[model samples]
Each structure stands twice: as structure tokens, then as C-alpha cells.
Target: MAPTKPLLLDGSTGEGGGQLVRLAVALSAVTGQPIRIVNIRANRTRSRPVGKRGSVHVTGGGLKNQHVAAIKCLADATRAETTGLSAGSATLTFTPTLPPSRLPRRPLKIVPESDASSAMLIFQAVLPFLLFADVEEGQGVEVEIHGGTNTSWSLNYEYMDLVLLPTLEARFGVRVERELRRRGWSQGPAASGCVWVKVYPVRKGESITPLQLPIPLGKERDTRGPRDHFEVESVDVALVVPLRLLEPLQTALARDIAGVFPSAPEIDFRVVEDSGHQARIYVLLVAKSPTGLRWGRDVLHSPPKGSSANPTSMADALSRLAVKQLVEEVDSRGAVDVYLQDQLVCFQALAAGRSSFARHGDGRGGGVDVDGVAGAPGPTPDIEGDGLRREKTHEPFGHGSMHTKTARWVAAQLLPGVQFFNKGDVVEGAGIRFA
Candidate 1:
């Protein structure tokens, strides 16, 4: 086959890293457009921990194992053709035998090489393409991935369970059934861990539906409605720890939340005897809003034996991290949480129709004589001709919406027509069809 007029990509583009490669390849597979990615993961470099098991340094700077795993896994599952798919390779050319529109009839499976490699990362790459797949007549895509479930530096498994799956299902009508046979943390007692998930597409050709923004953003002269504030309906927590330690941790978290949330929001705590690994504790917190927005945060660690550890301190930190993050996300008044904002950019772009969403701003109506700023922060909400400035502290986490801007830059690079603006966020494929 002559080259497929590949969509060109630079690994070092804005938010330059593995996600760009993962997303480009996923789009390639779904659109059946052969992809050519250079400078693959150009901006990402990590030092391999001096492993006690003699794991050595990763010398070259290029595609990481997880990126390779995501591509190869999806390709193999679909019997796709490819080249330049080796560890640390700076370029990749991938051609799927059939795009996701014409998915094969079977459950696709992916297993990474290292027990420490992240399952969530691989899932990010696989999911977009999978959304367009149908395993049987009228059935959605079915897939199973076995690898690191809660590895460090990647979104943990529960975030998908608490935030992503529910949001996709409710907002987009995507159906999925997930099962976690085993859980894996980066440095736990078990050499490796696993999670199993199955995704059903929104339809055969389209995997995702366009996002419905709470408020539309197209006209500068338009009147504004009251912004949708994410209200916490409840908080559900899961702890994987030694069964004996559950009660103390639960009691401590309950007390902390009572003080943190003076409103006394409903809280549910569940404990699992297994930490999914040999670790003594892994805590997951899921806070859901009445309108279905969600924010999740978790912490997992394998403490040294008999150290100067206080159960009170550990429990306090874990619970505080979870509840506190949820507070920040909800306070931002964003339709989605901070972490979800970045990843959703790709899905919005891939939708078969125009997709729009509310991109949260700091709500300052105007800022310091903003002029001709092509990508300037939005004007303050509900303010006109007032020279009042709401002081912003240097603390970056105060607003909690970070990477959505970087996500916009990435979208501009990969898909020329897609616009991720403050208002009227849209992704249109221009009627291009692949099957």
C-alpha cells in the first residue's frame, strides 16, 4: 500500500509526551489513517529507579514501554500492520488492517511487559479506537487489559471507576462493564497486579458522543446564565489494607471529613481485606456531585517494616488528600475535575459530530488590560467596566484546572480543525468516514 497520507505528528508538541503519541496512534487506528510520528515522546525523560532486582538504566530517549505496549497491543488485537514499534524508537508508522469502524468480532486483550507498567496508561491509548468497535452485531467494543492498575505517575484505576466511566456512560451513552480481578501498585509486595475492563461503543462508527456544555460560549454579546456549580452529593471511599487496620482508618477519615466539610456531607466507607498487592494500605476516595460530576484521588504505599509510622498520621494524610482534592475541583465550578479536563480533549476531537464543553476559567471578567491575546485567559464572569481585580494567590492548585490549556495546544497540533476554546469547544471531523 502506498503511504496512507499519514497524519504527521511531533512528539515534542505542547503537552509533549507519551499522551500525544498514544492519542495520535489511537486516532490513526480508528480513522485508518496511517500515522507518522517523529521525535516520539521527545520531551519526556525519566530515570529508572535503581532496582533492587538489578533493573538497569534506560539509555535512549524515545518511546517508552507503555506507549509501545498501547500501540502494539491495539494493532495486534486488530491485526494491524506497523513499523518502528520498538522500545526507545523515536519514530513510528502504524497502519491498522481495518479501522475501528470495521472492528473484528472478538474480545481484544493487552498485556504489558513489565508488571510495573501502567494499565491505565495503556487504556488511555486503547479506549478511543475501541469506542468505534463492535464485537457482535449491535454490541459495543469488548476489550480486556492486564497490567499495572494503580501504578505511580499515572491516573489510578479508581479514577476511571469513579469519574470517567460514569461520566462517559451518563453524558455520552457509552456502555461498559469493568471487573478488577487483581489490583497492582508500583512498588507493592506482589511482583505485578491486574485489572479487567470492557467498553461498549456509543455506536458502530462513532465511539463517543459530543459533550453537552452546561453553558454555550459562541457569542461575546450573549447573556450569561448562572454557572453550574459542582455540588458534592456524597463521598465514597475504598481502602485496601490489612483487615485489622480498617476500623481505625475509617474512624479517622470520618472525623477528618466532619471537620473538613462543616456541612456534614454524606460519606460512605468500604474496606477490602486485600490491598490488591502486599502493601498494607491503598486508599481511594470518590466524591460525586448531584449533577454527576466526579473527582477521585488515591494514595498507595508500601511502608518499611516497623518504622516510626503512626497509623493516625497515615490515615489522616490519605483521607485529607482525597477530600481536599474533591473540594478544590468542585470549588472551581468546572463541569469536570482538573485531571479529567486534559484527557477529554482527545475524545471531544474524535467525536463524529461537533462536541462542545464548558472550559472553566478563573471567573475574572477582565484581567489587566487584556489585548489581542489570541489565547488569553477568559474575561471575568458577570463584570462590565469595573476596574476591580480579584487578587489571585500564587498557589497553582487553588483553581485546580491546569492541563486543559495544554490539551488545547495538543489538539491544534494533531487535528488542525479542532478548536478547544474557552467557549464553543468543538471537534468536527469534516465528514471524513473510515470503515
Candidate 2:
């Protein structure tokens, strides 16, 4: 059936990040609506050639060059196809041929083996449509995406499993069943992977209420170095490789984490074999937060330089790097913590009423409160609270005034609010709401 509300998505939203594709696809699946996208990744990269001759423009140039060709939807699908993409400059256009009401029985198909990055981009563009198919129509959405699963520019399968899936499930209540039919890595033998998404719409009773600022209370602990004390709900590491390479990878990861946080308990690691040629690694970290559950993923591959030495070393380094980045962002006193802040937009939008996140003047304030308990505060506290002797101590929660300039702008556009603050407690508007 034709969708009632047509969501016109700007290809360049959220710091002009490709997330516009990701969110748009996911939302389409949930809402079962057809969306039109123009100027897709319009600002991504400039047209340039690797050398003086045989030079090809980047993403934009490629699109312009393909404009004159016989552009057609690939097999009644939402994606467009054109050969000689790098032949010349052209203007490309996209229009959804099939409405939600007229969607075919067959699952959506996207075929593009040469530019895995473009394939991934297309997936994000169409993912939302699939996700909402079942929920809106009470039927499952089957998707067969053909492209590089482990390409440098695309999201590795490991990250999809370890990080992205878990976050969606925990925060937004999304359930997806997937199978790795084949493995495809960058500049290697290509293969395919299948993902089945089952979305259960929130029951009337299960709807989440909007939260307000100073969302209260929780004790916090440092989980960084060895012997550091912090409670972890779960930690799972999965590497895409053969059994022979699994053990060494696991050992290296554990040792690395131990070196960073000795006091933390042993983390669990799992290995899944991939049929493709290239190797990849994905890590998922989950912990209880004051507000709810916090989840993070690190998807990376080994640098090509050391391919000859230790196969798993690259995986280990990537895992460690992902963890370090997450911890650092969470520990910062900035207005919005990076990943969580970004992922929270969907939840905030889906919320029944209203919700607010604490804004740290600098990314250095104490941890936020869940209900009434407080986590560690940032380096310097701006507001003063009561001291043990009844004197006023510094308080981080309400130190600064509510500056909703950016948030209001987003809210005005019917989008989520995103705020930013720097080290000197100077609040500034950020283009990407979540960083």
C-alpha cells in the first residue's frame, strides 16, 4: 500500500555523514514508506584523479559522469545502475519506482561489486525500507546485498554483528537475524552475506516516555587500566577467521585489555569462520549505565604492512583501538558523549514524549546521574553543591544554563536535538548533533 507519510530525507544530514543513508534505510523498513533522496553524499569527496591521466573523480564526479547513460532501476529495485561510471562527468537522478503498497514479494536486491563503498551507501539508503516492511505490513523483510563486506569504506560484517546490531536491539528494541553466506573483503575475492531483520513494533504499553534534563543518578568507576575497578555486564569479541587464527587473536586481545585494565575480569571472545578471502575483527562491549544499558563496537582489520608477520595482530590492534576510543569518549566531559549521543537520536525521536541529556560545558564533567546516584564528575565542576560540613561544593549537573540553540533548531525541523561544548565551558553549535 502507498505510505501515508512520505519522509523526504536530505542525503547530507548529521555533519553530512553517510548516516543519513543508514537512518533513512532503517526508518523506511520501520515505517514501510518510500523515500526520495537527491544530492546523495553530495559533499563527500571532490572529483580528482589518482594521476594526471586516467584520472577519475570521486563519488560526486562518478555520479555526474553517469548521468547521460541509460539509468535504470536494477531489477525493479530502489537502486539505480549505470555502466561506464568513470567515463565522463554527468548528472544523476534517483526516484523510487515502487511504492510501499506495491512492493514486490521478493526481497530487495542491490548489486554492485566494483564500488563496495557505493553498495554500502545504497544499503543504508534502503535498509530502513526493509526494517519497517514487516512491522508495518506484518511480514518479514528479506534483503540480499552484494558488495564488499570488509572493504575499507564499507562497514565490516563484524561491526554490523557486534556493535550496530546490539545497540539497536538494546536501545531501540530492534531484532535482526543474519547469516554470513559468503565473505567479501576489499580488493579481494568478493562474496555475499544475508541479513533478516524482524522488527516488533512497540506495543501500546511498552512505549517509552520522554525524559528531562539532569536525567538523574549513578555511581561511576574507571574501567581503563589493569586493576581498574568497574562492573561489566558483558564483553564479547568475535573475529572473522579460521579456527587456526582464532586462539592467537583471543590471547592477544585479552592480554591487551589486561594491560589496559588489570582489575577488569576476563572478557569472552568468539570466532566465526568466513568463506571470503580477507580477515576482519569485531568487538562488542556492553555495560550498565545510569540511564540504561551502554553498548559499543570496534570493527577493524589488520594493516596490510604486517600481513606477513602475525595474522591476528591486526585484529588485536583494531580491537584495542576501538575500546580505547569508546572509553575516552565516554570519559570525556564534553556536552555529548560521541557514539551514545549519536545513537540516542532514534530513541529520542521514538520516545513518547520528551527527553534530555546532560550537557557538560567541556567534555570533562563528572558522570551523569541515572535516577539519583551520580557517577564520577569531570575534571572541574562548575556548579557547587553542599559539602560534608554543610558548605557548598561544586556541582556539575546544573552548572550552566539551558542553551538550546542547536537542539531547538533540530526540534524545529522535527529532528532530534544535538549540542556541543568545548574545554573552556564555551558552548557552541555543532553541525553533527551526535558526533
Residue 394, model 1: Cα distance from true site in angstroms: 29
Predicted candidate 1 versus true structure: per-residue lDDT over 258-284, tens digit per residue: 776544668877444556333546777
Lowest lDDT 10-residue stretch of candidate 2: 388-397
Clashes of each: 4, 51
Stretches of candidate 1 exceeding 4 Å from the true structure: 1-3, 48-61, 77-79, 135-138, 205-207, 211-228, 276-280, 304-306, 352-403, 413-417, 423-435
User: Alpha carbon lDDT of residue 267, candidate 1?
Assistant: 84
Q: How many clashes does the backbone of model 2 have?
A: 51
Q: Over 4 Å off in model 2, which ranges?
A: 1-14, 21-39, 46-106, 113-124, 130-139, 200-230, 241-245, 272-292, 305-323, 329-337, 340-344, 355-362, 365-435
Query: Deviation in angstroms for 341 in model 1?
Result: 1.0
The alpha-carbon RMSD values of the candidates against the true structure, listed in the order shown, are 7.6, 10.0
